[model samples]
Target: MASSRIRTFPQRISGAMAASLGLLALLVTVRCNEQVPVIMWTSEGISLPRQAPPTAGHIVGHQQLASYLEKALDVGPRNVVLFLQDKMSIEDFTLYGGAFGNKQDGVFPNLEGALRSSSSPLVLPAVSWPASNAVIGQLQDQLDTSPLYMDPDTLSQLRLNASSPALLVFRLPYGTGSDLLSAKETLSGNDEVIGQVISIMRSQAVPYTAVYTGLQPSRKEAAALSVEGGLGGGRSLLQSRGGYKDRWRNRERQQWAKEKREVYAPVEFKEDDRTCMLLWAKGLTVGILRNNRWEEHDLTPATFGEGVSPRLHGSDCDKSKARLVLNYENVLGHRSFKLVFVMSQRHYKVSARRWFTLDAVELEYDGTKATFNGSRSIYAPAEYSYRCHSVTSFRWPLLVPRSAKDPANQWRVSFDDFQIQGFNLSGNEFSYASDCAGFFSPGIWMGLLTSLLMVLVLTYGLHMIMQLLTMDRFDDPKGPGISVPQTE
Candidate 1:
């Protein structure tokens, strides 16, 4: 009995080991399966919208539709419709109010009629994208079959083989609507046509799923549409710049003296504008620190809610220093975020021509500041311009928490379309500083010194070789100038 027990113990141990290995393999398999689909269904140029289409009842994800199709295949021969309409917005549909709370009438009458009749029609909002080759390839990969491309206008001619599951993809023609109401009518007609086709499919007892893709309209078009027949929401739509709001908005409401400024102050240039410094800055952008990096946030009218507006200060000329301040109310949890730039201006001579130099620059944001005091001495080269200078890339680092230890984790701010005038600038011509390469860097100087040393060594060696004349010390006096053989 003892011998039998010992034999079974090893057998039981082997079985346990095998079960653990199987479990490990299953975990690895699940991980691999989870990772593979993300890469497989990964697409580019597809932006999940921030706001839901007001008219599209609900939006469905690509994965959700794909999963539904996969399951529907098991039920019976499935007919899936992927209707990709071009440049259609959810606001165009009479289903919901437009982006600015405009009353949208029945733009999709036929489609609405069909939806009313159907018990459970799968109509959900999707992002607007034209059917690209990549999208087609993705669909093919998911369905394990090439989609039969058919025109939505000629859907009556679509002949799908009922024996096999069909993935029907219809790409409507691009709309040429001149105005908003026309655009609405055009989109409505498309929806009606598609809806009529869907109703026919239902009558044929074919199990079908329909998807409608819509675009977000441009500000220009929205404005034009608002003028034609839209409610006053068009102005609001044009002013909409999407961003997250922080708690600083309440603080900004109480503090009005520090934040209010003119949106646009006329730029004045004098005939002899040498004493003052004027800086013009457009397109203000703010960067917020997140995950130890600077994430860009475009400062817009809508970013700080309805009442507060972002304004640019410092259009007026200053005698001593040029100051340009971009103030944002309620930005990144701050009640007032000001990007202040102070540049000290001076007149100088360059190549017998009168030029101006910005000797020093001080940039301040939040609580930290980056000051660059340029060399103004005659010995050191400085950036001196004859006219106005424009800089597109002026980036400054902000002192963040981890930045003290790791420079790579620092946050930075950037400026664009920045111009400094009042330095004898005439007309539209700009003159940049010639001394961009101020001095040789340490590495360059080292390389130059190494090259000079090599040249000196080679020259010395050549001189020594020239001086090494072989003397005819071997005098053949006995042999009457008989020279020894050159080579023995």
Candidate 2:
């Protein structure tokens, strides 16, 4: 008795549209106070180098980043707490003598007592220092908790101390180098872990010292001279550098720099400058041309092998920096891409002629690449990676200056990032500033807006599509000989 018009209704949303809106709302809500362009995939990672990296190189990155933050708060080692998430600071030749002790936690006989000493680096009085036994024990537990993304145990340990100027280096699990069966499995939960960290940070009221990501190539992490390590560390070293002449050196360092010299002028080709990030599409095999146009660069016999293609280079100062990263998102056909960076030093050793150099490069995008670059404290490029240095990638941090000579007063380090945003697999490297005003540059915000619009349009289009499919309108009127297969 009822003739239905198929319950005609204008579909306003689809599952995809609803999901997109939810994510957008979540983004807007999560970033209410911040105007900085939101990067969603930033995940948690650590860099526990097998041995100690040099102090001079590792301390400068943070120092520079800290200088930028000091505008709001009086900052330094004394007031701030340092979290050596990985072996980066511990293993490199450069040393950072903070509350966390040395590579193995034995550097300081007593962290609390050390801070209390007159010669201690503490700017704040020992009474204000959070370097107590309980705090140290808590930190040890946190550092050793899961050895990967911050698990509940690690989170509990982190929350145990209310240290004011705390510095954290969340190590990527693969630094251990034992059970990384594949790439994705090794760099686990980077984006998820980052989200968790942001949640914890937001819940707190008192703003703590700056948060950072430690970046490096675990493969280049040299072996610890001590007997403390197990099978994993020794194996990783052999797998990467076993056949090389200098087992202790970065085989690819010099070559990385050589490429940079080709692109820019010698002056522009200073150390620690990023050239570009090489990206490839995901869900792709070695030979297939991605998206019918983008070329493939999966040199590895097996797709997505652990080794990185582009080499790295920098200065002897170990103060110069650069980074090359990978990326994948279905929106971009899940193509792989790179983000190269050139970071300037914090406590730059000023000379009549200022020069900078780099140590190693890290590959991000796949979760496993987090051990080195995810920390945000490291950078490198595929320049000149040839010859005698014992190691390639290591933990490098920058220290900031207290006072300035010019309002442009701040250091002028160039930044080159290679990005791929649209349907095109193409990208290019570029230079930018990290100063206060440039921190939130117009270009980044514009990109974010464009991405947001695209997401919305795609969502709405799908909503209409789903609506049409579910209704009687999309039904095959003939309903016969409809055995045609789909085509790409």
RMSD of each: 25.6, 28.2
Give candidate 2 misplaced runs (Cα > 4 Å): 1-151, 157-164, 167-169, 175-181, 204-206, 218-488
lDDT of 1: 0.41
TM-scores of all candidate predictions against the true structure: 0.30, 0.19
Give the Cα lDDT of each candidate. 0.41, 0.28
In model 1, which range of ten residues has the least summed lDDT? 33-42
Give residue 409's error in model 1 in angstroms. Answer: 56
Consecutive 10-residue window with the lowest summed lDDT within model 2: 34-43
Best by lDDT: 1
